[model samples]
Target: MTAPVFLVDAAALAAATVGGVVRLDGDEGQHAATVHRLTAGESITLTDGEGRGVHGEVVEVGKGWLDVRVHELVLEPEPALQLVLVQALAKGGRDEQAVEAAVELGVDTVIAWQADRSISRWRGDKAERGVRKWTNVVTSAMKQSRRLRRPTVEFAGSTTDLATRLRTVDAVLLLHEEAEVGIGAARFPQAGTVGVVVGPEGGISPEEVAALAHVGAQPVRLGPHVLRSSTAGPVGLTVLASRTRWTT
Candidate 1:
């Protein structure tokens, strides 16, 4: 089995490699030592969460610390094409679950979309809390999924704001059940990010679709069956990923 991976700083990993010792302290250390019950001589992997990784074995285990002997340090290059999921905020915390799984499925970035049909609203202090909550979710998912590259979670503001940002993306696909074109027909770029938009439970408003379409966002269908807001993004991303370098 592949060793369990923990996130560390790139510079710290670099310095530790020279010394041949990578230290794990703080909450992370406590978790590894106490919660995971990790013992000395067990193998573990450390990642910078930016594609850099180190494979090592625990040399010493303390009450709240661990020293690992570095064997190899590698830096993985970014994918030729990145996938970003634009998810509409939904109730019952399903949006977080979607992004969490999307990160596992190789989504490079996640943008929270506040659509007209969105049930949950983020404003004032609540906005900051929401971001933090999602950040925690994605972070945990990164480890759970054994992903080297940590996926980002950012609020996209209002739908109009998100629509305006579509101009900068290589391709924007809005998953609409009513659309005639399927995801297989999406016009992907040679390079850059492919943004996939998933609407809330109530679905995307026609006016909102028109607004996004005016800004080069294509309304595409997932399939004959309509999926939940949480399920749509991951399913759409799988199609997008398969069509791109993710399969290659």
Candidate 2:
């Protein structure tokens, strides 16, 4: 089995060298020490969630912390092509589900979209809480997937705001049911960001689609049948990953 991963402080990990003892504390440490019951001489992996990973063996364990003696340090290279997921807010917890799945599928960044037809609104304190919730989801998914880097989660924004932000991306593919081309055939940038837009349960508005298209986002379909708001982004990401990340 692959070694379980725990997140560590980036600065501390960077300063650590082979044979150095790195401490794991706080929530992650508690889980590692008490929950996982990691004992001395057990193999483990620690990451700063920014591409650096430390492979080590547990040297000591306490009530809520464990120390690992580092043996190897790896810095994963950033993807030549980045995948960004723009997921519209949906009712229930579907949007959160999409974010989790997208992160596991190697999405580089996730932008929450507050679409015009969205039933669940991220208003006032709920807006801040929503972003925090997605951030937590991304962290958990990263560890669950054993990923070296944690994908970023952005605050929820309006359709207009999303369009304005996506204008700077190398390429954007808007997942629309009426789109003529499949995502497989869509053109992706050679070495830049590729944004994938997935609408809410009510779907993307025509005006919103036009707005994204005006910013150079190509309308594309995932498949012949429609998918749920929670399913679309991950499916699109999987297709992109197969053609890009997985191939390499």
Candidate 3:
């Protein structure tokens, strides 16, 4: 069986021995020891959420924490495609679900967009809370998927800001149900970095789509069936990753 993975901060790692012991704290610590019931000598993996992973063995277990000794550290290079998901904030828990799936599907980044048609709004304190919740979700998903790196989540302003961010990447794909072209037929730019934008439930407004297109973002259709806002981002990331040979 694969080793169970845990997310740790940079300070939890040591360079000389390439390993360090950390005192697991909070809910994560309780879950590791009590919920998983891990015992001494059991193997586990630790990640710094920066594309670095270490294989370690449990040395001790306590009511509130566990001790682990790292044996090896490995660093993986970032993916070639560098897929970024510009997901419009959706109602209920749909947007959270999208962020979770994006991390599992190997997205490089997740940008929360306050789209024109979005029912959910992120303003002031709610915005900060939203980011924290999404970050936690992404970290958990990464651990579940045995990923060494956690995707970064950011909040974007207007369609103009989204477009400006897209310009920094090699290419941008705007997924729309109304688009005439299918994603499979769309010619992706030579692999480097790419961004995929998914609209909210109400769909992307014409003005917003035009703004994205003005910045050279291509509109591509997923398939005949229209997917929910939550499902579209992950699906698009998978396709883009495959087409760019990012996963091979």
Candidate 4:
């Protein structure tokens, strides 16, 4: 099995050097030491969740923390093509499901959309809480996938807000059942931000579709069958990643 990756603060990782010992503590440390039961001489990896990684071996284990002797520093280069997911809020935590899976699928950023037909609403403190919850989910998924970088979660907003926010994106492929074009045939820039917009349980409203289309979002179908709101974004991303990141 690949070495389990634990996240460390950027500053802590920056201070780490070859042959030096860096202590892992706090909740992450406790989990590593107790839950994983890492022992001396075992291999592990540490990252700052921003492309910086440290390869090391467990040298000591304490109550709630362990020490690792740094072996090497690794810095992952940023991808030339960035992938973003604009997921419409859905009932029964389906929105959260999309975000978690998209991150694992190599989505670079996530935006929550409050569409006209969305059953779940995020207003006042609920909006803030929702963003925080998404962030936590992204963190967990990043670790589970052993991703070197963490994807960011943006604040939840309305369809209009989403359209405005995506104006700068190079391509926004909005998943629609009635679209004439399939996502596989849709044209996108080779190296820029490409966004996938997934609608709510009720699907994207006509007005919402037009508003996003006015801002350059192309309505595209994933396949002949319509997928649930939670499944479309990740499946769309899989197609894009296959064309972009998965190939030689």
What range of 10 consecutive residues in model 4 has the weakest lDDT sum? Answer: 155-164
Global fold similarity of model 2 (TM-score) = 0.97
**Model 3 Cα lDDT, one tens digit per residue, 134-218:** 8899888988988988898888866777788888877888999889988887767655778889999999999999999998889
RMSD of every candidate to native, in Å, equals 1.4, 1.0, 2.0, 1.0
Model 4 lDDT tens row, 1-248 = 88899988788889999999888998889999999999999999999999999999999999999999999998977899999999988999888999999999999999988888989989999999989999999999998998999998886478778888999899999999999999999889889899999999998889988998999999999889989888999999999999999998
**Model 3 score (lDDT):** 0.83
Candidate 4 — which residues are off by over 4 angstroms?
none
Worst 10 residues of 2 by lDDT: 152-161
Q: Candidate 2's C-alpha lDDT?
A: 0.91
Name model 1 segments beyond 4 Å from true: none
Instruction: In model 4, state the lDDT of residue 186.
Output: 89
Residue 55 lDDT in model 2?
A: 94
Task: Select the stronger candidate by lDDT from 1 and 3.
Answer: 1
For all candidates in order, the CA lDDT equals 0.86, 0.91, 0.83, 0.92
Better of 1 and 2 by TM-score: 2
TM-score of each: 0.96, 0.97, 0.92, 0.97
Shift of residue 106 alpha carbon in model 1, Å: 0.4
Strongest candidate by lDDT: 4
